[model samples]
Target: MSKQKRNTHSPELKAKVALEAVRGLKTANEIAQEFGVHPVQVGQWKKALLADSASLFDKKRGPKPKPEYQSDEKLYGEIGRLKMELDWLKKKSGINLP
Candidate 1:
């Protein structure tokens, strides 16, 4: 048996087929045949388009908000403390670290 090469459809093509499916003017099988894809794919695209349509309008038009966490100064202080403790331990053990 030989495996057939998979077809990669562009986002524009997917949107077109999905829009056709959403119009109810043509069946999934017809849309698939016209677009050279499986009927299942057309159905899936249509479903995703319908489901995500609301998100297009719901999105805010600006940069994303920053996360709330400990400031960089606090983190740097902790790192310095750890380094000092490591240096003290190395000195007591006679372990020279370059």
Candidate 2:
């Protein structure tokens, strides 16, 4: 027999189902049936969801996100290109006059 392909759920859907699972609205088997997936998958999602949620409330949060900056090589390359274009324009148009 051929293998069965399972449908992938989005992060939002997973969170929703996990939240529902946390709320004790229905059994894992029922939720699995509702979402057309297996009970074990829902159980795993619920476990992960709770773990991450608990982390958010934990006192020891990690360091703040670092600011991303442009690389020096890229900036220098852009500056070089601009300077070359300016020089080319100066050669073609002559010096700036009063």
Maximum-lDDT candidate: 1
TM-score of every candidate:
0.66, 0.52
Please list the C-alpha lDDT of all candidates, in the order they appear: 0.92, 0.85
Off by over 4 Å in 2: 1-6, 57-98
Please give the lDDT score at residue 34 for candidate 1: 92
Kindly list the per-residue Cα lDDT of model 1 for residues 11-82, writing each as its tens digit: 999999999999999999998999899999999999999999999899898987765565677888999999
- When superposed on Cα atoms, how far off is each prediction in RMSD? 5.7, 6.1
> How displaced is residue 35 in candidate 1, in Å?
1.2
lDDT accuracy of residue 24 in candidate 2: 95
Model 1 bad stretches (over 4 Å) = 70-98
